[model samples]
Target: MSSPIALHTIQYNTQDIDNDTLILLYKNLLKPRLIEEKMLVLLRQGKISKWFSGIGQEAISVGVTMAMNMDEYILPMHRNLGVFTTREIPLSRLFAQWQGKASGFTKGRDRSFHFGTQEFKIIGMISHLGPQLGVADGIALASNLKNKNQVTAVFSGEGGTSEGDFHEALNVASVWQLPVLFCIENNGYGLSTPTNEQYRCEHIADKGIGYGMESHIIDGNNILEVFTRVTAIADSMRQSPRPILLEFKTFRMRGHEEASGTKYIPQELMDTWASKDPVINFQTFLKDQGVLNESLEIAIKEDIISEINTHLKIAFDEDDIVPDKTNELNDVYKSFEYQEIEKKPETNQLRLIDAISDGLKQSMERHHDLVIMGQDIAEYGGAFKITEGFVKQFGKERVRNTPICESAIVEVAMGLSIAGMKSVVEMQFADFVSSGFNPIVNYLAKSHYRWGQQADVVIRMPCGAGVGAGPFHSQTNEAWFTKTPGLKVVYPAFPYDAKGLLATAINDPNPVLFFEHKGLYRSIRQEVPIDYYTLPFGKASVLRKGDDVTIISYGAAVHWALETLDNNLDIQADVIDLRTLQPLDTETIYTSVKKTGRAIILQEDSLFGGIGSDISALIMEHCFEYLDAPVKRVASLETPIPFLKQLEEQYLPKNTFESELKSLLEY
Candidate 1:
């Protein structure tokens, strides 16, 4: 193993801070340590499920938290219980959360450091370690835009620095000059992987230099050193608004969790670190400085013991708040009464691209907190020139051109949405959304169901295959998001639906994946309303009504289904456009299928595991007896779209839908 970095000696005058303040600081450090020790006891007794102890790393959290103002936000990870204590989270509530009580932060949905209170400006960390860093960037960005003069402090372990999100977050923060303090708790070991195996750098702070930002390496065990430096940085950041990377060189002192054994750690190293324990060393320093006497130390200990016992009793008495079948569907999506707005007389003939642009403009004009962020979206408009002139109209602050980090884009949007801003993120191509899949699935989609939190983000994906855009450029990946719960999937074919649906997505209080067909951006034009209006989600529009067969489709495929029906006038198929896929307009679908016994489902995605399969299943379940024949599905070939014109033509479902319709009519 490499030799440890040399620690710079920091001197402090004990008299500078009053004895009461010093005693309270020591108590803050003691709170989490005692609580965690008790948590270990509970773990052994089956009172709590797990414990991620921050026993040795108390000084880092308490010190930094003390340095920041109470109004500022702190995004904490699982190991940072000291932060929760320092932030004045009630011990009873903390214990209640650990005990899975009804009065806890997540109402017993999550336990043990997996909960956060927006009221306290604390964003709880998800299972994925690195994405929260990007979220912190978004929080800081929002503060900057709103001129809040607040600095968001986000915590991570030395292991998280190796993740791609760390790089993406720091780069974006550096480029945008966001006010974020990136805190890395260098605990020497990530589970069992040692620092030497994790990265070659002697100090994790060195990575910050490459991002063109300030970097600091501090002795995390020293409370005075951490507080003194963090206070200075936090105060300066409010005015200058720049990100700082601070590495806290510390040790875990325990296993990754209470159940994990420490046999992997060498005995010699454990003994060496035990001597440098922050709590013991700080106590010794206080005694030497004549700050804490034996009598006072005993009194403080008794007081903390009494407080813990009181909270423990209350938490233990609380009822277990487990989810039941009755409340299972509660808070999945925000409930709103839908009111239909009549179409206006004055309408403009717009292409799909222009309608999307206009809808974004109208939404931004209505809500000042709405922000548009994507690659090349600000001045250059976008790759397809959809957001052209947005920067000029909305200004650069609202129209942001982000770095080429798709995961960060989505995660940051989640952060912004959590911070009470509506973020509309554009994936330059639908294929690139794979890079951001984790946040979309794990963080954004599950956030509401997990914590009663709303991720009001609109992720605009330019999707589908046409005009020979090839494999990388043209991909209909809507099936992936449609399958995920807590997400509203919107795929509009015409200009009117695109504008109306996009507007609704912006105003909706949940995460929405708005898929726009690149093939129809300029090819499809219709007379859309000039003024602002929103179409209700989960309401399918019947484009053409007929009695022979019912055809269901969305996005670019809807046009092909309609064209096929128009070409074969004798077929007389009822065409239904499912604009929103998640809160599927099953009422309209069932009604149409009930009317026309024969059904056909069409999609631009592949045949297997496509959204059409879900629709087919839905029809089979509800409209099975009504159907005269088996539900037929027409979808693209199960292969990557090729670049050649003929292959690309063969890859889409347009031809397949036409052929399938002919066979369905004959049946």
Candidate 2:
């Protein structure tokens, strides 16, 4: 093996700190190192499936955690065992989490440091790593909004800095001047890939300068330096709200995980890092300063070992979590029943856009903690002008404008929801949701099931074709979110349903994808009540009742079904408008299908894998015995929406619903 370059020592001053505080920091560092040693034994014995060793990087986690106030939030990555230990989370519960037992933070739903506890003010990172940066921005944003003077500290690896989310999150934090400490643990290797391969910048902190934020690089292996600098920087941030980037240079002493060997790393480099081991180096320093002696060090090690054995025994005695299909399915979403609106008021004729605006305004007035954000949503209103004049009424904080960053904003909404606030994210168009899909599906959707965290967010998606806006701006992609678990999908056809259902969506304790058909925003008008109201999800609205055949649809397709029935009075049919897709109104669908003895499902999305396919399968499975013919499906072509008016009209399912309804009625 080639000889490796020696690492430089970081200068630090600890004369100001008292002996007790310094000893406590040493204990915190030693605890995780010993616990990791025990876990390595468990991994070898096949008791634990995997282990991500933070053996040498303990100083970074311990120092940063000890420096921050207990109430301040921290979002940590996988290799942050010291963060949990320093925060005083029970070892028994943590062991149970590793053992996949019931008492764990996620109830055995997730593994590793992938779980979060609101009680400890720690939000765990998802596998993607980058989203947590945005989530930290959200927590800080909430703290800023409430004037709580709270600061958020978020951690990431040197490799994670390369992700787009890192840039988006840093840019947003810089623009808003949110109080967040962006800590990058530069551990030299990201799963065998070295730092040089990750980016061209001199240091990870350099990226922060591009975002117009103060940046710093510190020696992560030095415990005193880590603690002192982080404490001072965090204190400064609390009094004056702003984002700061901190790059801590450290080395990963072990492989990414135990299973992934260190063969990729040079033997000499590993040896070079071994000499500067944070835990050993700190112990030696403490002994030299007369703060710790050989006997005292031995006593602390013995105590930590005893504590680990006790917790491991408790975790071992716990019953294994056997999976139950029914229980697993039930836990996918939070149990929230339909709520009824209290009072009724006089009605006024309004367009779908106006009704949505009224609903948002009323929701904001009702819930003071509610925040709505989107590009051009505040001063310029929205693309559809749905939130026009909202900033004037609610102020810029509640009704804010966001940069063209869909992914980061979605995660920010999740973070806001995490901090006990309701948030609504508006995508300029439904097609734009693709950019924000990761956090929505992997994090926000699974938060409740995984860690009992409620992401009370409403994402407004302006959808549908026929407007000649082309594929990018115009698309009915409700099916995209409908297939994912833990999200409520709502698409209303008229002004009354739009207003009522939107109110309900805003109040839902889970993430909701509310699709507003841009094509119907101005084309349709109805008598909508000025007072706040709510409609139940998972309950389809029967727009028209007939017995010949059942025609079911949602969003713009519901209007097409009514139009078809209006034109063909002879073709009597039951038309059902599904308000929500995920919590589907299968009861209404089955009843209508059984009574009519036939069914025709319609959708604005393409035929294959669309929501109509699911509806058809359900009807055939439950109501097949009463069927007169096969369940028919009318939908747009399986192709991208066109920009030309003529092609868009042809691409829409409105022109085909009438023909399909007649065919089903005849059969």
Candidate 3:
């Protein structure tokens, strides 16, 4: 690494730091208070809802985060109320958010002042505390990928250090050597629990040592100290990717949440903390240095208050950015609160591969905003060559190659989307998605519910097994994400459907998980539309119909079902291919079961806790009466996928479909 730099805990008695320079720094530090007061005042008048104050913690936040570029990024917790002003977040929009008005930042879809942004890299807040830090690591990783001079400044509470996610993000950041500055605001409490109870370690700064990082313990209220440490760390980060730990010894001075206060705080301890208040201490330190006086301090406060109020006025007075005017369905397949009848094409023409490739070409040709990211996809056009020749047609920026950090890749895609770009991220192997599970479940899936309308990226994982992916590469894992409500999960078996579902997912406002089966990538080839088009989300297709045993499946298993029923005279099995796992096609299942009186559920995922389980449960709830006999399920045996092809063949569900169907039919 670079030469080790030591941060002094001793007094800085070095070269003279000019009085004028210090004053300017102090002015920047105090400027945020103007907005802080304005917001709190509005909250009291019921002009807004509630606030988690940064009233006494301004010096540390302003000093550290302002040292960063706004176009860079930050994942702030509740105490980031101070950085909001430096971020130039419109106060009127904040008020609108507080009042739950249509003019709010998220168009009344989010709470006061905590929401995502399209124009700025400033992320919306996360309610679960440590989850936001995971995103911070992602943003920094994205910066590394894009070759940009930016660092992600993540703020969290001392209490958050106890969460497994906090450690996970830190470990991944260290492993990837990401450019991230972690600021742990030691407000002496972790919610109702105090620091003394939460940890017995010396300090959070020491925690970085385990990750081979340098850390500092700064006076949280001392703007000068904060600025020096944070800037130096940020500068070094840009030079090379490395994690830095910063422990800002600040105090809460208020309750954890808006409605909650620190009544549990003893009056004597509160008085002691008030005496050490960062805002007041920094102001006093400035006066002692002869850099601050009564008149000058008053003037600075007035000017800042004026500046803050002006922005607040603009946000409050300005009109809202209306949501989609058409008020369409939640996703492409399902119109906003409306359903469309999807009739099968009269002709059985295009293979699924051609359809998928054609869809990519049409969509990219139509929208200048769409970008494709994956490994080897640029040169090799992916393992299946679905994206072949696209890089030559569209430049590298639109079809970018990526390093192999799965979680970090997802993080970057999510960040770019949050910044108003439409990004598509690919997991080369579906099993590798385990690497990015943290971002998917904790950040991307929950960002909107935590703040508002934060879904920005669409993730594509090539999933399912048929041609011997064994366990690692072939398993169908759609059910892992289907139960998660916010994300849209699509698994199509044909070319036309893949193109349509992918187009819909790309345009949908929320994050989408498109699971393309590796086995079907080449097997399902067909003539795709030469022009651009979008297929609706939440729609299913019935490929073949019969009044016998009904087989319901998606992705590779659908094709397997088609083959299972192919030329079988004794078994007239109806086939239903559910393109969407999230909004399961219960109607199709019920209709088929009522007509056939026997049913078989099939997927390539593990037999335990997979999509088949979900479908079986639904049938019990809605289609139990139609069952002429017991329902049967076909899925992979419960075991980790083995590398040996023969063992994998036995473990997988492909060979079981025919036999399972026979059992259901005979029952």
Every candidate's lDDT: 0.87, 0.90, 0.72
Give candidate 2's whole-model lDDT.
Answer: 0.90
Write model 1 residue lDDT over 219-317, tens digit each, in one string.
888887788789889999987899999999888889998778688999998866776677777777787788889898889878888898999999998
How far off is residue 506 in model 1, in Å? Answer: 0.3
**lDDT of model 3 at position 160:** 87
Candidate 3 regions with alpha-carbon error over 4 angstroms? 1-57, 64-74, 85-121, 127-153, 156-220, 224-277, 286-355, 380-385, 388-391
Between which residue pairs do clashes occur in model 2? none
Candidate 1 at residue 507, lDDT? 86
Q: Summing lDDT over every window of 10 consecutive residues in candidate 1, give the lowest-scoring window.
A: 1-10
Best candidate, TM-score-wise? 2
Backbone clashes in candidate 3 total 18
TM, every model: 0.97, 0.98, 0.70
RMSD of candidates 1 onward, in order? 3.1, 2.4, 7.8
Q: How many Å off is the CA of 576 in candidate 1?
A: 0.2
